[model samples]
Target: MASVQPKTRTFAGVALIDTPLVNAALQHARAIHDDMSFNHIHRSWVFGALIASKLPNFAAVDLEVHAVSAILHDLAWDYKSTFSTPDKRFEVDGANAAREFLGREAPDWDSRKRQLVWDAIALHTTSSIAKHKEPEVALCHFGIFADFIGPAFPGGIISKAAFSAVIEELPRLDFKEGVKQILCNLCKHKPETTYDSFAREFGIRFVDGYEVPSELERILNALDATAEV
Candidate 1:
């Protein structure tokens, strides 16, 4: 579908890679996500981009891919969206859906570039791992982490002015409440998907009757089922 009136909301200056593909991706995210989730992801991108600007290594990084990845990082959080699957972890679901979006809308993007977006979205939650990946992947992770926590990054803090501007544009409206509801919804309906991911704790705490079998038990259960078959 043609992009609607530009919901891609990046900060002024700082050389944004304002392309149709990026705008389309942002627009798509705006359509499917709730206000809090939408604002969070955009904030993540802004935070990450600001960080990347300080590092000389990020010059070679593809900003379009990074923007798209950051914009749609939490796609499957809206579990009711068409992007979500019954059993896939939310990260994988979001990554797959992002690839699908690129395949359909930005056909000119090569497989490697599309996969870069997938890696960024899929690995956004894994700071330990995502940091070791390509620039796009690592930046997405850093951005999400910055927004989730405070913006006091490792090398230095993000500019206070920039942070304020982003927050002013995207006012966080009860972000924790919105996030808890989404996580609880995931646990309530797709408990299997939350079994080993970040949502597991949320499931245990928030979802009634949601069991997390220990690693040993999981292995034993598999082996026993195999023996029975």
Candidate 2:
């Protein structure tokens, strides 16, 4: 008897690019994120597919989860986002939004799949960890980082031309300023939520009057207390 063959997913360097879900996710992201972030999401998915192509089980990867995670990773960057919640990390806001979107649009998805997408978006900012999580989570993190900082992929997985093509399709528009503005908004509008993430340090460095105790200050205080003993 012949062995069964697993289903293989095709890659087009775009997340659900030709599917209705792509349009839906794009529309949803456009309403919430600035053009920069919207482009980031697009490139993130494409870059993620680039990363996925090098994985051991590349053909078996779930494109739906990848598309949802990439498209919604930064959905909460804007305060006006329907997914934005006060006093929660930006990642959480994006994760919640992804969950809600799936519930409404892809209600047939099992809880396990939903949770995978949620983790992918929620943990995209966490380093060393997201890279080790499930495939969707890890790939989503890699995609976000690769888009922002060239293809810093392991073993130089993707070729320059491939990366360039994705960039041409989705140009990164004023991404630096967009990131700065989003960080400022998070600190200024939702100061409480920035505490546990890099946004906290960003607030201290960029946002006026937004002060958090420096790591050096904390170390010095610890040393002073030890000397008193």
Candidate 3:
């Protein structure tokens, strides 16, 4: 008998199943199976990487788990988005899928490591309720922050309302100081720069060009004030 070829899954203008597991997850999220695309996953990865770079003493193990989770975090959206707002259930579904896939394909990964991946996926989409005490949870929260910053392509605009929500949800810290530090680091590359610099460097071009919204503008202004003093 002749050998049979297995069918393949194509998504988001490309065949991503051949890609690495993390990349495949991103592609799956962005795939055209439904209304949402892998763009969201792509944005999450970009933002996650940037945040990971900035975090103090971020663990490589935690980062690896976060990368995997960020890509696969919304894999169940194709089914979940249809019924209701993509929420906790959606995350649980994705985590379950990730655990199953990882078990079959990455058997070398220990249970604890695999669980970290699942935990990251479960929490990445539920940042508001995430417990910062857990390193994986913090990494997941970082990925969510990346999503909010509009790192994804097309319609990656962070509206004032969205920014407000993030500020309210984010742990109370010296955000203005943090922004200033990030901005100062950014200015080293371009003397006259704005939020667009941050966006462009991280491949987060706004759909309508890189314009800082009013809320972000206020944040930037506060950062500038702190820097001047």
Candidate 4:
């Protein structure tokens, strides 16, 4: 919640996380997201970059785009947002917000680049889809998953010391609670939008009388109608 200077991270003399544009995006994100979400975004970029560096053709990775995507991926979860609407999924809200910001500030980035950032943010929470997209998308998806669920892939890629250094810089204080609160708010304000999405589970668990029909129920109803026919 407290406004803090955006932290910087560099790789091979290239500014990955602290470029002027990235800092500007961070400023926008920080204005809405609390410290927990802000720190998580920073760590997600670092983690994604680390994974990207391990790829056979690492040169293809675009750090600037990745930084922007990771920074703005959770913007919809912010308590306050000028970009959010009631009917859209939180991911789409974030994707649209980032796209709008880029369109206004970096007109030269071209449509493909903007879509790359949009896909990474919109599909970051979707594992099956995001993993099949571009390397930037896959890295961002896995990086966020790794941060929340622990390293699920080849572990030796990131040394313990390196991991500790990142955590030291951006401490993960109250992140779980902060994320829970965001999910709760989504269910509270937009229960209809959560149906068939990841947030549905959170809604079912947190919101009173919030229920979606189970898959088995649908199948049984289909069978009963078939027997009557």
Candidate lDDT scores, in order, read 0.83, 0.80, 0.51, 0.79
Candidate 4 structure quality by residue, lDDT tens digits, 144-189? 8767754445666666666777777788898787778788788888
lDDT (Cα, tens digit) per residue for candidate 2, span 63-116: 768877899899887877777888788899889988899888888889999999
lDDT value, residue 124 of candidate 2: 92
* Per-residue lDDT of model 1, residues 1-229, tens digit only: 9844423334733445677887898899889887899999888888877778888867778888888999989988777978889988889999999988988998888889998999999888777899999998998898888886655666666766766777888888998888888998998888888887788888889888989879899999999999998
Q: State every prediction's TM-score relative to the real structure.
A: 0.89, 0.82, 0.48, 0.82
lDDT of 3 by residue, 1-229 (tens): 9954423333322222233666555555555333223544554554555455455645443555666677776665443233212233445666887787688667787888888877777666454556453666566656556554543412444444543443343332543344344334333332223333232333223222333446677789999999999
Alpha carbon deviation, residue 192, candidate 1 (Å): 1.0
Scored by TM-score, the top model is: 1
**List of clashing residue pairs for candidate 2:** none
Q: After superposition, how far is residue 160 of candidate 1 from its true place, in Å?
A: 3.5
